[model samples]
Target: MKLVSVETPEKSVCKMTFSASAEELETASNAVYERTRASYTIKGFKKGEADRAQIEADRGEHTFWYDAINDLMDKDVPALYDAALAEHGFVPVDAPVYDLVSVKKDEGFVATATVALQPELNLTKTTGFTTECVTPEVTDKEIDSVLERRRNAAAELVPHKGPAVKGNIVHIDYEGLLEGKPFQGGTAQNQTLQLGSGRMIPGFEEGILGHKAGEEFDIFVTFPARYHAKDLAGKPVIFKIKLIDVCVRQIPALNSDFAKKVANVDTLDELRAQVKQQLHDGKHASALNRAKDQILTQLADAAEGDLPSTLVESTYQLQMQQIQQQLQMQRLSLDRYLSQIHETRESFTAKVRTSAEKTARVRMALLQIAQQENLVPTEEEIDKQLAERAERTKKTLEEVKAQANVHAMRRNEGIRKAADWVIEHSTIEDK
Candidate 1:
């Protein structure tokens, strides 16, 4: 075996010159012939009968035999080389091997292979990274806010014979038309509008203020430019309206009974305790995320080396795809989302690029740490992970294996292990 070329980190192309025995060559030739016979269905040949004429014709067709022989060699030669390498306690890198030979009677086929292996990562030590996270105390004020929302949610609406109040629910029939033509979704029948609720358009709820039941009127209004309806946007329209009834919100007293009704807590103190615990949990989660962000920022700053552009670009594309999917889930398109936010695709792309770059850097850093720590998953561990994944995804092991590439899965596991290690070793300051 002679080295043809050497690629970095366990990739190489090599040429091997060897003589094959007559029996060995005969075995290979017979294998190729059998494969060809099985693959092609020649008309005029009896079933399972060897057609010498057809075989000869096929051999004469250089392109046909060239592909056939090359494929045969491609599939069989690697195993032979691997076997040879095993004898020397070395494994052949997983790549295709080709044979180059002169058409001579006794000359053995000379083969060349381009091989690849897992890259060797030599990671440098990373340090000087620190993160400050503010875990806010869940105060009485925050708990009170949650309690107020709960109270409002359970508030009762009572018929108000007097003037409409701020929290009153007013029943009305309204028709909005643009250019004297009613647009789709621009009209509602006997819809309940809550005054000062901010549930309707900016000018809609206030337009019917101080109106009694059974009153009829038409109010001129202009649709905001950011209105969902494209046709009526930024256009002046008249809302033909009729007031049906008015009811005021009767807010429950902030007492034990109200707490029991809204939160299933027997007392207001219990409700406050529950709300405070929830607020504390939410605050802790937010603080942890902030800490992770700070850690990642520091790690990215400390990280040194050229990140593969291909990897970063692929990551960016995946992030963009996820964002688009989320927008789709909300029944909006990326364009519509940008329009709603008053942003362009370029601005979104820039924002996504920043996030993607940070994620890629952290991922690469974790991988390097895993390598340095020799934190590779054992074969048994990998199998266990695969089994769990199959169970979780409701797939058979074989089906999961077919769909989820095992090698990639292992690599991801390594990165996860590295991240776990980083979090375990890091110093966390609670505020």
Candidate 2:
């Protein structure tokens, strides 16, 4: 094998060309042919008989083998050329590099090879940008609002023999049937539903307004077109419901006793102070996230390099794999998920492409920042982060490390470090 030429540009990419001998070409061709055959299932071949059949089929099938082998050779040669370039310290296209050259073949059918080198950045002089951050102040009214919610959560329900009222709990026995056939998940016995809570289907909740306890009624309602149950979707059903009882929730006034019940606070004043602090912290975090997003948007706009198309494609594949896994966890298929979201794969892919591009730009920007600022994480820091992740995920360190590798967690960490650097140095004008 020999090297022909190499070219490296300022945009962190390398290109290389090389040649291979007839023997090496034949070897790669055979390997590719074998792999393809192993995955192929010919008719009338018994279980586990495909491999033997494939080999036998190849011996007498010169035409089949030749076509398959030639196709493999076409693909394997370029891939092998890439491998050879890397082996000789030359970077291939899509690989970051800062140098290039050409070389002549020594004594092979493969004529020549080109080589490229990975790019390196000088960490000292790049201008680092920053943003301003401020902690938010929580008001007295906000604290009181939180206290009121806590009181409502701790309220007690008192039995009443009157008509169902707003904010009251109503117990009912109901069965919904479509065309006189009960559907799955459509029947309930003695279910407690909060009146005016809007938790149930839109028309279902409002239909019970005038019904008193022990009253039986047939309420005809149409299932929303987007309802989760495929069988009931866009169908009209009649629910036979008997109202059993109505009970009102009695909430205690916001006082020292109520405050103590809700938390460890000894007085309402202390509870208000704690609630205010909590709100202040929440608002501050929200503000920081918004500021970080703005800074990242600007950085992406200012970025000056071509992103690797291969990397974006790989990221998309990973995203798809995650979606597949989540669907599996929920006992669903990709088709079901798409139906639920009212999306097709083509539309979903188009939508995700924009997000993928933004993600790729953010990643590239962070990597550039890391190189420019000498922000490489130390071995100790990596280990500590890995350990913390393992503890938080309740997995073994090795498992966490492996999963992190699969999920590009290290790359995400690098991006986070870059974000921290940007946030620490930039100026912000709050609106």
Ten residues in sequence with the least summed lDDT for candidate 1: 4-13
Model 2, 1-431: lDDT tens per residue?
Answer: 34455544334444544455545545544665565665555666754356644655655533233443345445555556656556756432232221212211232233322222323323332234455556667877788788778888898988877677777799999999999988888899999999898888768878888778889998889998998988888899989999998888899988888878887789988888888878988898888787777777667766655565555665576677887899899999999889999999899987777667666666667666865676757667788989998899899999987656422454456667887886666666554
Candidate 1: C-alpha RMSD to true structure equals: 12.6
* TM-score for each model: 0.51, 0.50
Question: Which regions of candidate 1 are displaced past 4 Å?
Answer: 1-124, 137-141, 152-252, 261-266, 328-348
Q: Per-residue lDDT tens digits of candidate 1, residues 1-431?
A: 22223233322223344334434454555556676665565566665464545765654533243443455465565456556555544322223334465433254344454433222233444544556678788888888888788777887878788766676788888888878988788799889877998887767777778777778988787888988878777888888998888887887899998878877889989989988888888988899888866766666666765554445565688899999899889999999999999999899899898888777777777766776788867778888877898999999988877676555566678878887677666666777
RMSD from true fold, candidate 2: 9.8
Clashing pairs in 1: none
Question: Can you tell me which runs of candidate 2 are displaced by over 4 Å?
Answer: 1-10, 15-132, 176-186, 196-239, 286-431
